[model samples]
Target chain A: MIGRVMDAGPGEPPIWVMRRRATAWTTPQRRYYQLVAALPPLRDFRRTRVLPMSQRRLEERLALLHPEDLADLRMAVSLVSWRRQPINRTTAEIAAMYEECMAATRNRALRSTVEFRMNVRTVMVALRLKRLGRGVPSGRWGVGNYTRTIESRWTDPEFGLAAVFPWIPEARVFLDQGDATGLESLLMGLLWTKLSQVADRHPFGFEQVFAFAFKWDILHRWLSYDAQKARRRFDKLVLEATSEYQDIFA
Target chain B: MESLVLTTGWMGIFSPLALGAIGSMIGVGRGGLAAAGAMLEVEAGYGRFVGVAAMPSSQTIYGIVVMLTLNRPVSVANSPGLFVLGVLTGVALLISALAQGTACAASISASKSKAEVFGISIAPAAVIEGFAVFVFVFALVLAGSIPR
Candidate 1:
């Protein structure tokens, strides 16, 4: 029904075609393999060479890609490889490396998403390190130029946690109170807010679909952790968002 | 009487209105469904979604204007002018409305969650409206040259 409504004039491209074109610019092959590795059932696999979303599917889908594409694919495989678990990389370092990998894809929306996630992750890790009274390794942040900004503000009392992510100040309160559940919920909410903005800014592109997929993944992980808790948290977040909307619209 | 109606160019008089109605109906219909879907996800801030959904309605207004501009008594002499301008302008409006509807739908869906994007998301629909305006202005300009 939605499809019929969206299909307009003869010249208008179909939604599926738009989706393909939008998503084609991103590292879809790498994303697909990452998803495969993230799946609990598949995580134990030493290699995903035999996975349906892996080599064969990638080759078939991206037959036009040059050798560089294959090289990128190999890099992704190495990153997701089970052996990499033994590496002593910090969360910030891992995130930075992943973001650097995504930057190579040359998709604007994907790059924005990676950069946004990197900033959020960097803040979270810095906060954790601060709470432990450890020094923040400013050099580890993966987002290129922003690393220096993050470093300077790493321990700046006034310009710390809440200042970095102005959109979700509640995150600071949750973190300060040691409310693990609230912090997790707030983090997801903040991420959703960014994803929603991306979807809005690029309505005709793959960002909307990516936002939905990212939300679904977060929700799924939350549910797996504790279904009842996750549901309650989600309902609360929606209520908060709705109330904020009402406040503005009223 | 039928022969008089033909010679008098009733087709020229009604052409814009008929095409306008068809175009607006399809355009609004497309955007309306999207607005409904959007409201399902976020009940608040519905006014903006509805506004975006109504973007295609401008085509109908353009159609009405063209109809009025071409409203001179249809004689064999002026009938061809009316027929060509009215029909072509109507077609342009029709195509523009249909395209605008799709953009409006996308806007509504996107703005449901991110209310801040309501303003920016409407840009694509507004761009589509520009094409409709070009048709409207050109039709009016061309109508001035038509003989009475």
Candidate 2:
């Protein structure tokens, strides 16, 4: 989550796509593999990884790569063999880089994946936004940078919730009616925002906040639906905080 | 020697002045000065917790002794006062815990420590502990004045 999307935004030149015989796996494929890895007892889907043709193509392209590494590639991509090295090398270049990189690492390479998106538009937008930052060498005079920061982007914070939107056949169990995506977007986004804020203010994250609240068993009381109760809960929490100050701060 | 202890409605509650004494000797006092220093170091992203943790342990020991001398074999199940005292003891422990936790977080932020990423905050943990102390002190004073 922190790696690719968080730093980049709406306007940047599109990332030049090389279209690897394997350039990079699309975002969906990466997410799919990631989800598959996490969902245990789903071994049936795991067997389809070995692709041999891509393996040979990768081997031919990167002359220094080993055959066992090539065998591993076949298993990773589920390919039969490499009929054309240069013809498919653009995509395979991405694959080869990953395979070579993995072989160097101690971590066992189970899946070969890369950024599915080559968003030149997002790049251009980010660059445009960056351009807004520079008024002079002294880094003075630019009102546009502030505007760029608050500017809304399409693939915003709720991307995770959005991805799960279609798959959730029923809505009632998790959410209250009325545009679950919008609400989930709002709620989860709010939660993510709160989580981020609390994490920022304190030395922890929302998950930790949840655990702390879970320990107290009514963390939701701090922000429950009943406004009065939530307020009282907040008050109690605040008084408690003040008392803590009295303990150390006093 | 004159008794420095104070009374409230005919009950002698532990004094904040005494708190300073107790805290100084056992709970975050001279013994904990090193730890306090360590705690501050954590916010700067360093690991000096050996000393930081020491302060609270000393303070907790003081609480344990203070309550134990006033009451014997303190347990939450048996001694209502001590149970509350135990809560207070837990709170006092958190001052050190807070320092240590913060130091640990700083260390983590600096990539000097591995444990900070979980981000389970110590502030609430300390607050939760403070309630125990408050209840303990209340019970101590209330029990003395009230008749069974």
Candidate 3:
């Protein structure tokens, strides 16, 4: 779909907007802007290889990196100081530490963006648990207004998720059918919507950068999980958006 | 003495033109670069970004107007008035144009990522343009009161 948009010539009523929406970023572009700026030389060096390689080839290389190799890769790309200390930690523990570090960031914009993203992830988890008919472990849900929002929607029959998320109907359909993959995709869509809202609301400053970077992550995850499905979704989105544009132009 | 007075008059007339040229150059240059960069990311709305970039060029037009309004012969007495008015107004236009360019650039960047707020995003740039307009109008009005 992106290829189709890229190949689209002039006289098109800008159907490329939706195609631009789902960009993939290997690193958190905004979060590490300063670091990247500091390592311009390294970036320029890597761009020679990274920009020319196919997405699959790049992923293949990334998949083969060891943790120490990952640390080296980070250093090579970002010039950030790294250590190869032999300490064992579970994914949850690492995530907790990351959340702690993100909370500790002095930049208020970065902090809020991280919080919002974590909150969305937590909401997805909570919804998944609800779908599985399992109870949410106490004190485990992440912070943000979304925690309350999801909890209210789950516990109160009258509180419709559709009030906050217009796409809730589609999500609910997936949930009803017990299509976990579909639900996950819908959850990711909801996340992009929320992030775009935040970015639009705070358009002038750091939030724009944060939104772009995070959306890139979503595109990356979607593409990696299922490239064919991602392509189909993109094609559908392009068709829908193009029709809307045509209506306006007409 | 006559030549010196005549030269001062020429300078007075040229001051706004020179200042305005520099102001508009920086203002338009900055805004144009930003708009171009933004266009790379955005799929459409080229007209909107380009329009915002043109905001800085108004300062130049204002400067030319002020020059025409100060069209009288330079004299010992009126030279001081022309100098003050032309220089101060030119400076105001310059600063306003530059600041407005920055504001426009920021707004363009915001809209590149989120296109829904394109209309409202340019509000800050418009506000900055308002300041430039205020200076332009004030200078034109005040130039009339200066002794010819």
Interface Cα RMSD for candidate 1? 13.2
lDDT, candidate 1, residue B121? 88
Q: Which stretches of candidate 3 lie over 4 Å from their true place?
A: A1-95, A104-109, A139-173, A201-206, A224-250, B1-26, B35-61, B64-138
Better of 2 and 3 by lDDT: 3
Pairs of residues clashing in candidate 1: none
Runs off by more than 4 Å, candidate 2: A1-250, B1-58, B73-100, B103-148
- Candidate 1 per-residue lDDT, tens place, A174-235, comes to 77898987787666666667777876675434454455445544554454457566688999
Q: Per-residue lDDT for B36 in model 3?
A: 71
The candidate, 1 or 3, that scores higher on DockQ is 3
Whichever of 1 and 2 has more lDDT, that candidate is: 1
Could you report the Cα RMSD, in angstroms, for every candidate shown?
A: 17.6, 27.3, 17.4
Kindly provide the TM-score of model 1 when superposed on the true structure, using C-alpha atoms: 0.45
Candidate 3, residue A23: the lDDT equals 26
After TM-score superposition, the amount by which residue A63's alpha carbon in candidate 2 deviates from its true location, in angstroms, is: 33
Q: Estimate each model's TM-score.
A: 0.45, 0.24, 0.47
- Candidate 3 lDDT score at position B113: 64
Interface quality of candidate 2 as DockQ: 0.01
Query: Scoring only chain A, what TM-score does candidate 1 earn?
Result: 0.51
